[model samples]
Target: MAPRFTVRYFVRAADAAEAKARALDIALEQTVEIPRDVVPKGYVEDEILGRLETLEQAPDGRPGFLATISYSEDDVGGDFLQFLNIVFGNSSIKPGLKVEDIGLSPGILSLCKGPRHGITGLRARAGIGDIPLLMSAIKPVGLSTAALARLAHDFALGGMHYVKDDHGLVDQRTAPFSERLKACVEAVGEANAKSGGRTSFVPNITGPADAILERAKEAEAAGAGAVMIAPALAGYDVARMLAADPDFSLPIVAHPAFSGANVVSPDCGFSHRAFYGVLHRLMGADAVVFPNFGGRFGFTREECRSIAEACAVEMGGPKAGVPAPGGGVNFARVPEMRAVYGKDVMYLVGGALLQEPNLIDGCRRLAEAVYA
Candidate 1:
């Protein structure tokens, strides 16, 4: 057997015969993309082609077969994009072929360059130790830099470890990236001075491709503690490229702005854990934001919990990513969230905190609730 990594996909099929046909289709569709009659008999057929290793019925009442197919690392060539392509490229376009798990081979893991500042690193930077962390966003867009800065200040004073820009708050005319980044960083600094907390402003760096690196460097120079990117908006590789850059020191936090479609489907798209947890961790995200269960988003308790588990699973090399679940989260849900996610997660509360009569006090109350 050639050196290869496994990819587990759920193929909708009624019986072994149908399952065998679907699995073979996947093996060829994902690799050669040509007719079986034409697969030349040699290295391409034996080594380069995707090999279906195992096929078993999905557990319990699930209506599919779990097909484990192995693809050679040679096909990847140490390229992250190609790895993604090989994993789900054409297969994603086909219905009833959902990606369940991605098994990284030794060669792939060596190329991973996983989270530079994953969970523990994030805590160290925020001067926090073990205990769930708190994060809030400065939002509603269209606001002036000063107004946004004030919000960052209040959130920091309220003891949020991270105060990030709303994903939509990019370089708008009212709040240009440079102006907003400088003001927010300074405001958070002042708040930290008064509160004796190490809260850091996290500016969103998702924007035009040519300008993202410039913004990241600017954020670092402006003293922002971390930076966020809607990888689904910018590009899947954006986070990975930023995380891999040696000069970029700020921790990378990934936002799920346009990623819902990839996991919301019943029998298509990637699994919640595969997309939000493994993908973000593999992309070097210190933390990943997703819609929490009980939130306005329709994620279930089991789906959310699986994401949390994947974030901290014993990967053994790459440091664990932190799962930050938000969307309609409020004070009433703190205990429930804690029970579901434990201490390894980051509690992200946004609009609810901003709607409070006193933003600072609201944040303080949330921090208190988390600690309790």
Candidate 2:
């Protein structure tokens, strides 16, 4: 009798009968993980067990069936990880199964509450009204704190809305996190004084589990515009927990590092949209960064669009998140990207801008192109 959320999985099978059996197996496997013959009776069989709501052939011409299995909220117990276990759990280890989409129930939303500063909030933070946002990263991990901070300053002066630390930049000795953060904050503060622009300096907070939340708090205290984290690398729940924490209030920029294996397979792991879009939103990422189409990562235009749409789709109460596509984004592709994502996206470009002799001028021109 409890409320239930649905998970749509693409199951490979030769016939409808086999597909139905596989879906039943998932219902049992994801929930009880026991023999069907002895799955207990009464409450376990009724309320706790997952219900197979629908099963049909994949309309996309794929050789599989889309099976929707709904599970009771009682199975989740208001715990996020438990909820995820019910969503994927042991099911992920088995081949021939792919998580295509997950329905967000009231239980899930009540548990997570999604992003604190979603699309509109990020746009407001950038001091822009109805325009696409610009973001870039300070890269080459071994740079000194002063050098990295200088890149932060120049990026701000060039009209970037948010300048972030490269995901690979960690608490290395050359540019200690504390030292780099302080330098970037100060540098951007100096840039704001001259440019009269509200460019925010974002720092990467991805690190060991015990330290990331501490780093996020430090960044917030240090006047960082936002904090970036590779949720897949730092642990997905880490990002969600920070967003749920009342004491930590900085907007989260999610990076899709080390996530290819979960998505590259044709019939396993997850779809590009499900992994990069829905997962990030659930983890409360204001901006979900991913490998863009026409980029070196080999994501197709359709896959990129699916992610963009998922970021801003109407998902009950949670606010729409912004999709940030990077990985080889350049000036030449701006117009084409704009055509696909419209005015709500944040273009993450660095090498293309840094290649220009005048970093500020290059950024300005990119902004002009975005506006046009």
Candidate 3:
């Protein structure tokens, strides 16, 4: 009898039935390597030492596994990234191999603080309570800094609570990150002054990995409400670093950009919820953004629900992160989205607001819908 870790796979490989049957046969008969060279050591025996059992079917009829892996604190080697890599490192490549839940021993789980600023903290900052928060994005990436700032002001005036830079809008020559950040923050402040509203302007701080923290600090100094980053693009460790920084404490929003490739395959990669939910929370994202069900993205309705559930579910931490569903959400869809996501969520709508002939009116309509 040895110590074991639990791994719950949400989606199995498309051909997992066959692969799993082979795996089971091998497990019963002899030694088996889970992900070939990725897990040189017996992954089943090493990481999941004691708890290796299979469930009948996932909610979607995908098969799943609950394995008790044997992982050593020594093997973790005192690195969080390494810990994540060791646990889900290799399986991320196999389609349908999503590590749903990691039953870390008390000692291990203790090391993970999830999110420092979660749903409640976010609500407190936004000065809203018990209602779905409405968010918007300043976009198209081609707009000048002044034009983007005007967009931010319009969204804030319209009553949106959070405004973020388009993920694709980075430090382009047309709109340098610093210029865009200053203009947007100032515009939001000006709008707030006139409207007496408290919309949050969250700029995208996805700079070179080394400069991310500096940019985050700069945004805070510029009166920005919160900041966003694509951990997969900038580096997941960078997000953790921002959260851990004592000088800048704005809420961190995690975006899913380069992450699609990680979960698109059925047999390998991390599940959408796991990447956007558990890991984002663990890395200290106050809000985690993902494509919504009805969006152009291929995420299913159940997958969207699972992501929302993961954000709000009790994990015994500061508070649950806000699940911000983005990707073509609009005002007309607010009521329906709210019904599905409920009150304790953040609704992220982009492009639509920008497309509105009257940005302020559009924002107001969205705000009204969310509040209604």
Candidate 4:
């Protein structure tokens, strides 16, 4: 038998009989996408079709059954998108099915090299030791390049380990991508000179497919410590390509800009851990950013904790990445955040720092809060 990858799915069905039927439906829908009778026999049916592994009642008390399905490694042909299609593609459109987890075999792991500069590399670049990293965004979108650069300078000087452009800050009339990247990089450099701190600037490089790589290389040329990309917006494989490329050694931060639907549903799309943690890590995200619990977004404490665990958990050979919880995070929540995520996270506090009477002092306070 050929090596296979496993995907655990939550199937919303009332009884065992219905669950069995749904599981069969998933096997067909995810693989051949044809009627069972029409599925060609021999190697096609035996090796290409998804094989049902197990089915049981969901442990979450929901009216569903958890189903595990395995697919041959040849089905992916060493393609990441094909792997995604095998995982959820057509079944994603059907209701009551959520991706719970993915088990990648050694063959699948060899297809894509995970994060190059994962947690350890990122920490070394920032000159930090075992403490939770601090990151803030330069934002409010419409600001000019100079204004954003100033914000980056203050944040870095005040001890923010990584300062990034807001995901929304694309090439607007006020601040083009090149200008913003140049200014922010220079600003952060000046701050590092003054404070003797190893603050790194991260510019959002999410754009057209052709432009994405160009912007990334340009940012690297401009002395950016890292580049942020919304894989959901750009492309998941784009993140993987950047992380896997030896020439572009800068860390890649995975932002959850357009990926809410993948995890917000209780019984659809993907689990928080599978999408933000496992998938992002597999795609070479050095830092995966998601909305924190108690924020404007409706993620629960359990979901948030699960995501954190998945990022750092032992999973074959992929290097562990950082879990960055952001939306609506504030300094007051640092202690609680630390208690929940421990020291392996990157505390992402954005707007809260901007609200401070003095930006630099606010960031200084945030740093103190994280370490204290």
The candidate scoring highest on lDDT is 4
In model 4, residue pairs whose N, Cα or C atoms come closer than 3 Å (at least 3 residues apart or on different chains), thus clashing, are none
lDDT per residue (tens digit) for residues 1-372 in model 2:
888999999999888999999999999999999999998999999988889999999899888899999999999997888988898888888788998998988888888888898989898988999888899999889999999999999999988999999999989999999999999999999999998989898899877778889999999999999999987788878889888898998889999888887888977888888888888899899999998899888899999999999999988867788999998998999989999999889999988887889998999999989998
lDDT of 1 by residue, 1-372 (tens): 557988999989889789889999988988888999999899989998899999999885678899999999988888888888889889889888888988877887777778888889889988999989899999879999999999999999999999999998988999988899999999999999998899989999967789988788889988999999888888877777778887888898899988888999977889999999887888888899999999899999999999999999977577898999999999999999989999999999999998899998899899889998
The candidate 1 region of ten consecutive residues with least summed lDDT is: 104-113
Tens digit of per-residue lDDT, candidate 4, span 1-372 = 679999999999989999999999999999999999999999889999999999999997999999999999988988998999999999999889999999999887987678888888899999999889999999989989999999999999999999999999999999999999999999999999999999999999977778899889999999999999998889879999888787788999999988999988886899999999999999999999999998899998889999999999998988999999999999777878888999999999999999999999999898888888
Candidate 4 has an lDDT of 0.92
**Cα-based lDDT for every prediction:** 0.89, 0.90, 0.74, 0.92
Model 4 regions more than 4 Å off: none
Worst 10 residues of 2 by lDDT: 230-239
TM-score of each: 0.98, 0.98, 0.86, 0.99
Task: For model 2, name the residue pairs that clash.
Answer: none
Cα deviation of 351, candidate 1, in Å: 0.7
Better of 1 and 3 by TM-score: 1
